[model samples]
Target chain A: MAIKVHGIALSTCTGRVLLCLLEKGLEYEIVPLDLANSAHKKQPYLSLNPFGQIPAFEDGDVQIFESRAITKYLSRKYKDTGIDLLGSSSLTETTIVDTWMEVESHQYNVPMQKIIRQMIVNPAYGIASDEKIIEEELEKLGKVLDVYEERLSKCKYLAGDFYSLADLHHVPYLVYFMRTLKSSVITSRPHVNAWWKDISSRPASVKLAESMRI
Target chain B: MAIKVHGIALSTCTGRVLLCLLEKGLEYEIVPLDLANSAHKKQPYLSLNPFGQIPAFEDGDVQIFESRAITKYLSRKYKDTGIDLLGSSSLTETTIVDTWMEVESHQYNVPMQKIIRQMIVNPAYGIASDEKIIEEELEKLGKVLDVYEERLSKCKYLAGDFYSLADLHHVPYLVYFMRTLKSSVITSRPHVNAWWKDISSRPASVKLAESMRI
Candidate 1:
């Protein structure tokens, strides 16, 4: 039986899980949800993920949600099949990976998502984009990128020389931002821009980014 | 040599790392940073944690930052010492734990911390609490707890029957909220209240809670 992913491919979180599966060269089926009809907040989908979120995963008897968690699970489960994403080779390596993963969760994703919501989602729904909020988020994001610029200067990737889940996690959001919003925040920084180019150019990331267009 | 933690004892993020160490029965020394003096943003600390965040951990040659990351590192490093916080017994159990940990990161922590910042932190600094923001956060928090209530009714802990790192991560924020703000938000939900009692009553949690008073 193939692994089942309950989500829309165009969703940011769903894109996250899809990228992991792509990187692992794993075959899986996506069980699409009707977000327009509020299908996710209803009974069956709620049973899969109590939080009423997209991108829930099902494999055998195990079920999980939270894109990061699902990706981590897949990375650990399929680690032998593809490039190692978790960096479990050593305690130190794994710690560095985990540290940057936390950084992504706590720092980067919030502002990036906010910018997306304001610039993309709001306008798509006929709602006006709040320029002030976008500016504020961009400013905060710039500070975070300054830190990233420093870190990337020291290492090839956020975790270290190897490309881990930390780098993979940034792809969907960065792609969305680059497509919809001003790219200067990322492109302006030398190391950050170089790092972005390197990560986004990966075959797996390219495939995932292309899929997200639909 | 004991692990050296560079953070203030009373700080929430610092308290999180401390709770994990106490749970693992590890000896550690605190190298306090004067937050009011902006010591964390200065040289030595920035080198340890590029983000200039609280609670950077140092053990031998390994140095890590991000409170959750440090706790995860400690849990993985000391899995055999005390109770296994990661629950790496099976892929299923670990996935469940990781899911709730992400829930803690993405969902629960945000509004909870916002309410805390408004109700407690701002007031202490002579800033008035924004009632509207507090109400908004509490409403968002209420919905999250409804989901928690549903999850807790199914399992004894957030991950499952075992008290994993998922539960430990909630302690510092909940403790701060309960001590400073009203406890009714947690207490009102039957299952959530019971789970809180079970986690907060742990010996390690008790010690950490008491230590946070200073």
Candidate 2:
């Protein structure tokens, strides 16, 4: 049997895993879980993912959840699938991959989540938007983006010259981010925008991203 | 030259790298950074760690920061040093290690930071402490702890029975946590407390933790 992926279409986390799979040239069936109905929280799904989150991977007898973990697992298990998602054999390359992952989680993801919660989720869900708090949070993010521009200026990708999982991991977020920001941040940083354009234009990336629009 | 570790004793992140070194039976010099003096954020140190964080590892020509990445780098580089901090041969075990690392970063670290920010840093630094927000945050964390308890009930450690980087990653937070919580959440979870006792009793853990304390 092929692998089964449990995920919600529109989720950034699920999009993360899907993009990796597309990069790896792996074939798998998507097992859609209804995020609207909290299907993931139920027992059957919980057994597959104790955390009760989507984007759970079931590869034959093995099941792995957590987007980064799943991506790493896929990279390790199917080495011949496609590009070296983990990066080159050199230690420096691997550390760069690890560093970029931490950068995403610590610097980008945390602040971006706050911005999303305030600017998107809160207002969309009928909660009053705290403009002051949102502005403060966005400023923090904008500063971080300045660092991103600096880093990208030095290297072609976040991890280094190579387009590794580091770049891949941020694809979905950037897709939504640029759209939400109306390309203001991306347009400001030419290299960053160019990098985004390059990755988003990939055949696999374009396909996976379109499939994620359900 | 063996290696020089620049870190603060009381810092959780520094303790993370220290514990890993002890576990691997590696010899290194500890150069204690003065947090009060902003040593980490100043001049040469800041250049080594752009983020200006503690637990920066320097070995030979290789300089690495970020505790989790440092530990992973050490485990891989010194493959024959001692116990494997990454994972053993088992796929489940390796995935579990990565899984718990995510759990630490995503769930454990987030709420802990919120609580600490409100209860300790904000108050001590003359910043505002929002008790209401802290209370709300704790309830969110309490839910994650419950899930941890359920997992610990079956396994001996966070990443299953073996003491991997997953367990090590959590040590510093738990230490401060024990000191901070009026009502002990770990104690309430019998299995988790048992696991903590097991890890806490290790000689290396005790020594490294004590020596690193400011």
Candidate 3:
């Protein structure tokens, strides 16, 4: 049976998972949950994911949620496909994957949420945008970008020499962020931008991006 | 060479790593970075963990920061000890682990920070507590606890069957929360309270809590 992914195509997280699927050259069905129709909050869907979030996944009898986790699971389950996504099962490489995953979730995700809230969510809710606050957030974000730049200079990917899901997870948010801000922050950080460019230009990423209409 | 963990005992995050180490029956040196003494911000330490966060771990030449990541690394690195701390390599189990981790990080950690700010941090800075606002935050937190109660009714641990790092990540926060909150919100939720009791009774948890003076 084909894998089924329950998520909106346009969602950055869903897009992240979609990119992973495409990268692994796996076929999956997109059971898009209409967020506009309040489908996510309704019954059945809530039973699948109590938190009422996406993107959720179902493969035959198995079901899972959380984009990063879903991607990691898929990577491990189908280990021999397009890329060695999790790296070798050695202690060092595994630690590297573990470390960067935490960095992405804890350090990067928090600041990115702040940026999203200020730039998109707040204004969409008819709330006023404070340029002073936005600029402050941007500055802090710039500092984080600096860290990425330094790290990328040393290695091709966030975790190490391998292009694991660690790099894949960042793709969607970076795309959304770049789309919304259209700023020179990434451009200024040459190594960071270069590494991003390398990943963003992948055939899998391109196919997923196009499918999601990003 | 022995493993060296740099963090203060009283810190909740630091306690998480200790709990994992204790659970695995690993012997390690604890190099306490005195938060009161401004040691975390000093040279060498800051260089190791760019975020300047506590609970940094050094095993031989491999150094990793972030408490959750460190715990995960320990669990995976020492899997031969027969402790099934990590979620299954399967897609579904990975999703469960990821979801609970998100719950621990985004939901639990956020409200706990709010409670700490209003009850401890603000008061430490001589800021007055707003009783009305605290009550509002309590209602928000109560709902989160309700979700936990619903989940614990089915599973022995947060992430399905096994006691993964998801439960361990939440243990410290529960320590602080139970101590500071005078209300019956937590105790009112029977399942949540039962889950807490089970976790608190664990030998590793007991040892970590005692070591941290929690």
Summarize candidate 2's per-residue lDDT along B75-137 as a digit string, tens digits.
888878888877767767788799889989998899887787777667777999897988888
Report how far residue B68 has shifted in candidate 3, in Å: 1.2
Q: Model 3 off-target regions past 4 Å?
A: A121-132, A211-214, B34-37, B87-95, B121-137
Please give the range of 10 consecutive residues that has the lowest summed lDDT in model 1 chain A.
Answer: A205-214
Off by over 4 Å in 2: A122-128, B122-129, B212-214
The 10 consecutive residues of candidate 2 chain B with the worst lDDT sum are B174-183
Interface RMSD of each: 0.7, 1.4, 1.9
RMSD (Cα, Å) for all candidates, in order, is 1.2, 2.2, 2.5
Better of 1 and 2 by lDDT: 1
Which is the winner by lDDT between candidate 2 and candidate 3? 2
| Top candidate (lDDT) | 1
Report the error of model 2 at residue B194, Å: 0.5
**lDDT by residue for model 3 (B1-214), tens:** 7989998777777888888888889889989777777778777897677777887889988899888888878887887665767775655676678778867886677777677667666776689987776777787788788778899999878998778888889887677667665447778888888888888889988876776442
The estimated TM-scores of all candidates read 0.98, 0.93, 0.91
Q: What does the lDDT come to for candidate 2? A: 0.80
lDDT of 3 by residue, A1-214 (tens): 8899898877777888899999999999999787888898878998877777888888887777767777877887889988888765687887788788778887787777777677766777789877777777788778777778888889999888889888888887777676665458787799988987898899988776676542
Report the first chain's TM-score for all candidates: 0.97, 0.91, 0.91
Local accuracy of candidate 1 as per-residue lDDT tens digits, B1-214 = 6799999877888999999999999999999887888999989789998888898989988999999999999998898999999988998889889999999999999999899888778877899999999999999999999999998999999999999999999998888788755689999899999999999999999998887763
